[model samples]
Target: ILGLLDDSPECRAFKQQLADLSLIYGKRGERGTLVTKTVNPAPLLETLQYYFRQPADFLEKQIHLWETERNERLQSVRKTLQDYPQDVVEKFERHLKMTENANQLRELNNEWLDVPIMNYFRRLVQEFARRLTESKVLEKTIDVYHLTADELQEATAMLPEVMEVRQRVHERQVEEEKFANVTPPAFMGAYPVDAVYTLDPLTLSYLNTEAPNPVDVPGGLGAVPASPGKVIGRAKVLRCTTAIN
Candidate 1:
């Protein structure tokens, strides 16, 4: 942590957490290192980023200065060659061409360096590749550059005409969210909602089944209300949630 700058609110927050946790849990097995303090690295990071950029700016300025000097040198050599003997003029042209060739190569390299987009894209691809590899869905990862833009859009977008059933449901949810300002219906009858598919160290997928007893498990939210009084035709009872979260 950089001691030069004042600690920000975020640093103070985590420092408090470390103190609280140490007091609450003490040392693990009575031999573990006690959580004593938190270090704020934001100030150090800011200093490093600015300090490195200073040298880079200086080098860029030097390149411009060198180009100006190289042009002046080439003009002076060509002008003197025009008045010299034929042999001298030939040697001067050869020297000029050699320097020009080296300068052109440097110019091309500079062009490549100026293209910061490639650097940004490379970083984006690396992070996406890492996430895909960690997910282990297809047991491997592919370059994001190879994936079409449309595929990425489909994964995030919830257009109404999406073909996938999961996407269609997702689109409906998106539409429902727009009306979130409209509070849920009054606290009457069973306003059964979605099922919570929580990971309890095993496959507890049967958290919302009904048929057999309909009201066996209390934690499973039991059965839907009987909708007493008037005989409201035969509408859906929604005995329990259908799908997973």
Candidate 2:
């Protein structure tokens, strides 16, 4: 059994700490998913236990390998940058420092702030959903998302009939599905003429602005790898959140 199956206090606390590990703390729409989406801890805990069984130095070795590769790339880039003027090198160094600092802050925020807060909120919602289901106020736990915060509060105070709440949820869900196939306009009531082109480099990158050009390859696809390694496993594509199952 995975360590997560243990009923010990330590194991329970460990699971609680990482309960939101898979939460998508990104923007709205398709990218927005909460810890509630993956309430079960078995999958994540099982994967971690499998890795924990590897050699004692397994993780350390991987980190060392990555550091070596990164240093090599840095030296190569520095050599190439030597051909540029001093001011250019200084500008590059400044940008590099800024990027490193930004990344550090992002990691700090995710680990200490975002993850804990989101998971705490998820637990609260789950507890409320459980109570709502027990009181026959909700058809299911996940249906809690159908009600706005104020509506949910009212539901708690004034125990409404299940049919009435369910009907309200159904209507809202139907309205949402109406826009499933619709593509939103690129700009909505824009004011400035230069607004489209005035975005900073970082903002444009975050928006995933188009590539400068496209390249054709012979019967193959390419992508920038998020990490260094290869693994053979069955791949599944999730087109929508509900498709996960």
Candidate 3:
């Protein structure tokens, strides 16, 4: 079960579990390596209380919808498999079941385990950052991200004069600013860019760097559709957070 982040005795125990779990679980986005943002205690507690008071049936409805969709998909698959050999059909059905189970497990882990653990870790780091800021060990709470876990711990325990740490953070921040303006090449090193698909089949599954089997149109490029329809509008393609802002 997922534990709520709060000051209650049960939540205090959950926080300890998070400290141990933090070594393995973390955000998987661009700032995955950095300490996550803190949850504001007042707002978080208020949100929890509000939800508890309102008792919605959203989960029950969602479960019903999921069951309906799964049944429809399974029926469709079995109908399609009728012409195939018994052994082949059995193998396909088994694979489908395994895939469904794996997907469900992944969802449960992400919602119940990964999110709560990471948020608790975020709360931990942000609390440490606030203390460091108060002691003048760090200029800003966000600067705590520039320090590694070990460095942060040392700073917190030993309370060293962090002029050097400040300098290091400044230099790294400068490098980040420099890279902000630079656009990276799609493919690098000895491998030819055009041959990326041929060289690595897994690249298609992972990276969205290249469009597969692009077709030539009158004035534009035609691409494979991942979804059903097309909506044309003014779209801004942003490479970084600065551009998004």
TM-scores of the models, in the order given: 0.21, 0.41, 0.44
Candidate with the larger lDDT of 1 and 2: 2
- Alpha-carbon lDDT of model 2: 0.66
Over 4 Å off in model 2, which ranges? 1-82, 99-120, 158-167, 181-211, 214-245
Model 1: per-residue Cα lDDT over 6-58, one tens digit each? 37877667656655665444222211222222234455468867778686578
The residue-by-residue lDDT of candidate 2 on 122-240, one tens digit each, is 77888878988998988889888888888787787775544348888888888888988789998778767432233434545655685332233568554332222344444556668
Candidates 2 and 3 compared by lDDT, better number: 2
Alpha-carbon RMSD of each model: 34.8, 14.1, 13.0
Number of the predicted model whose lDDT against the real structure is largest: 2
What RMSD value applies to candidate 3?
13.0
Per-model lDDT: 0.48, 0.66, 0.65
> What lDDT does candidate 2 reach at residue 63?
97
**Ranking of all predicted structures according to TM-score, beginning with the best and ending with the worst:** 3, 2, 1
Q: For residues 1-245, could you state the per-residue lDDT of candidate 3 as single tens digits?
A: 23454558888787666655554553332233433333324454567677676648866877899999989998988997777666656667676676567554354454445655676688889998998898888888998887889888888887655434778878888888899999999777776644433422233444436545644477865544332233444445666789976
